[model samples]
Target: MMDVLIETRGLTRNYGEICALKPLDLRVNNGEWLSIMGHSGSGKSTLLNLLGGLDRPSDGFIRVGGEDLRVLSEDGMARYRREFVGIIFQQHHLIPYLTAVENIMMAQYFHSVPDEAEARTALERVGLGHRLKNRPGELSGGEQQRVCIARAIINSPRLLLGDEPTGNLDHGSTRVVMELLSELRAEEQFTIIMVTHNHEVAAWGDRTIYLDDGVMVREELKGD
Candidate 1:
């Protein structure tokens, strides 16, 4: 059996009278790839935010690596995110002034001492060896996103979370990014959970869970 890496029970998030997440229950095992799908207001992002400790749940439990997120303080959550969770968004969010190499190194610097050599290796792994010195403004959208991926994994996170990673890219770039994500996940063996609206894109995941109005509606497993 696969080892469970993420677990949630009755997880919920609320904003005033609006309930963004309604007691969601989910489990993702280590090295597994999961996609989340839902309508615009389906609370998919909210779910991702809660799992990533970007937001707190109003009720229920969230356990990753045997640590309950609810019990963590602000600093604790920041430490958790730095050490255990890697996050990506449709926006590359790269520093405009920094080169790809520098962007990757920034992560290392914040968490601890920076390793320039390791940062370069990470960019090379993402097939950006030739663009290591290129700043975000100089690189194409796809290249910038690759740099983001390299930065995300530089710390060797145990879980990778993405929100609309390909939402703004063209079809070709979407495929390119997805392929890179798959390759890296396999090489690193981190659990991945992506939130996307495109069914075709969601199909790339090993399993997919559908959401509606903050509730888990269904799940589909495509593993053979």
Candidate 2:
């Protein structure tokens, strides 16, 4: 059995005539945090999507927590997406009508039976207990993003995948969110792969990878 939590070999992705990603090799150990940085159309998002199972790779081996995503069926992949990978989109995709807790509850419904108690606890974990009753429109941007994060982790996923989670926030809020992400990652012991263009945000990860033209060009490990 491989000790690596995530390992991809010769991963390739394409969209029509456009080559979204080239054959790439990447590895992430258990409980490690990895960040991918690149400019727009550089295949950063494509790599994250493939890792999270939102998009299938044209060619590659994708292993997450012992499961080979490349071989999973559609239903199996959906289950993996719900139970194994937690995703944080750049846009806080909370329902407009649902309150913070309700939004999390909806996520629960998709993955399994809704557990209000667990949903509430997830919101509280993100320091949004006070705003649980407030809808996304009523809460601040940071708070909404926190709710999104809470929803993402409600299932206790083994891998937390994020795509520019703090891209829309201010510096202070970005710091707060990044700090919260770092804290939760340490406490939950989950592997994290975040894609971002911000250097500061990438600095929060254990390793930073630079992608250009669908290829990984640079990587470095940071000491705490």
**The best candidate in terms of TM-score:** 1
Distance (Å) between predicted and true CA of 212, model 1? Answer: 0.9
lDDT of 2 by residue, 1-224 (tens): 43698889999998997889999999899898999999999999999999998889998777778888888899998998998889998898889998899999998998989998899899998998888899999999899899999998999899999999999999999999999999899899998999998999999998999999998988988864
At residue 155, what lDDT does model 2 achieve?
Answer: 90
TM-score of each: 0.97, 0.96
Clashes of 2: 0
lDDT of 1 at 156: 95
- Lowest summed lDDT across 10 adjacent residues in model 1 is found at 215-224
Q: How good is model 2 by TM-score?
A: 0.96
RMSD of each: 1.2, 1.6
Query: Candidate 1 — which residues are off by over 4 angstroms?
Result: none
Clashes of each: 0, 0
